[model samples]
Target: MPDTPGDAHQSLRDLVYVQLRERIIEGEYPAGRRLVERELAETMNVSRVPVREAMQRLEQEGFLTVQARRGAVVAEFGPAEAEHFFAVRESLEALAAQLAAQHATPAGLKSLERILTRTRKAAEAGRLRETVSLNADFHRAIVELSGNPLLQDMMAPLDGRLRRLFRLTSGPESTSPMCTEHEQLLAAIRSRDPQAAADLARRHVAGTRAFALSALGS
Candidate 1:
């Protein structure tokens, strides 16, 4: 059967959803910023219908919240929510690291090493945005190495939320420590030491949580 217009439209909406979601998480749309369907549709060169669908998708993803009269605003993270989010993420990432250490292929380690190198360069160059992207890539590579689709799926949402928080607080001081942690994670993976990898991952995430809380004055 030929692809219907509806299918094409859904694909377009999904694409729009991804773009808008990233912008929101990157703080381009900052907390309490309203997303107007017409404006977004015009900006993205798509129809209002697709923009609406994209907005709804982001809202469901917890990146946005629809108010009774305020329209759609970017979601805000509070101290409590931030604490819980990072705590849960720390646990999950520890498990992912342990699994990856046991299962990571040579190719996966190489990919992670490449990303780590790129991340270090980005941090040194003061390219905060690129550093954030590379940081995400490094963790994603490790998650994929775990050989658990379900665990990867579970990590996806947490990763997105964590990226948003990171972007909000990332600076020269923050990036340096993060770069060092990434190197340690890579070294652990290279040694194929599951316990060390898990310990390092946990400490890395905990450090981030503390940094984020301090920056947020929480």
Candidate 2:
């Protein structure tokens, strides 16, 4: 069967979503900047339908907020929000690592190793954005390897926010250290030590929380 109009519209919406999300994450659309459907549609040379759809998705992901008088604006991610996010992240990720240590299959382990290899290369090449992105991928891969559908469901909403925070806190100096932490966590998981994996995952979250807090403060 031929592709339907709905399929084409959905594809455009996804493209617009990725582009807008990246712009917001990269600070191109700073917090409090209003997003107009018409303006963005003109800027991207696309129809308003896809732009509107993308903005709606972004708002749902916590990247944008809809105002009463105004339409949509970039949402502010303040220090207080970071604190709350990290507190949940610490517990959630610790459990994921523990479960992964217990249940990860050989194929899952190999997938994680591949992500780590790419992460190391990105960090070594001084690619801060790519490194941060891969770091999230590593954490997410572990969560999936945990063999827990509940955890994956819980993480879905926070995934975008986590990536935003990572971009906010990561720098050239921090990328290599984050890689080291992931390496240790992966080792614990590979060893099939639930306790060790949980501990290392907790510590990793602590380090990231500390850095995020410090970055937001300064």
Per-candidate local distance difference test: 0.86, 0.91
Q: Positional deviation of 154 in candidate 1, in angstroms?
A: 0.7
Summarize candidate 2's per-residue lDDT along 83-166 as a digit string, tens digits.
989999999999999999999999999999999999999889998888888888998999999999999999877887888888
Alpha-carbon deviation at 198 in model 2, angstroms: 1.3
lDDT per residue for candidate 1 within 133-214, as digits (tens), equals 7887888889999999999999887778877887876778888889888888888878989999999999999898888888
For lDDT, the strongest prediction is 2
Question: What is the TM-score (0 to 1) of candidate 2?
Answer: 0.92
TM-score of each: 0.93, 0.92
Candidate 2's displacement at residue 17, Å, is 1.7
Report, for all candidates in order, the number of backbone clashes: 0, 0
Give the per-residue Cα lDDT of candidate 2 at 37: 96
lDDT of 1 at 44: 88
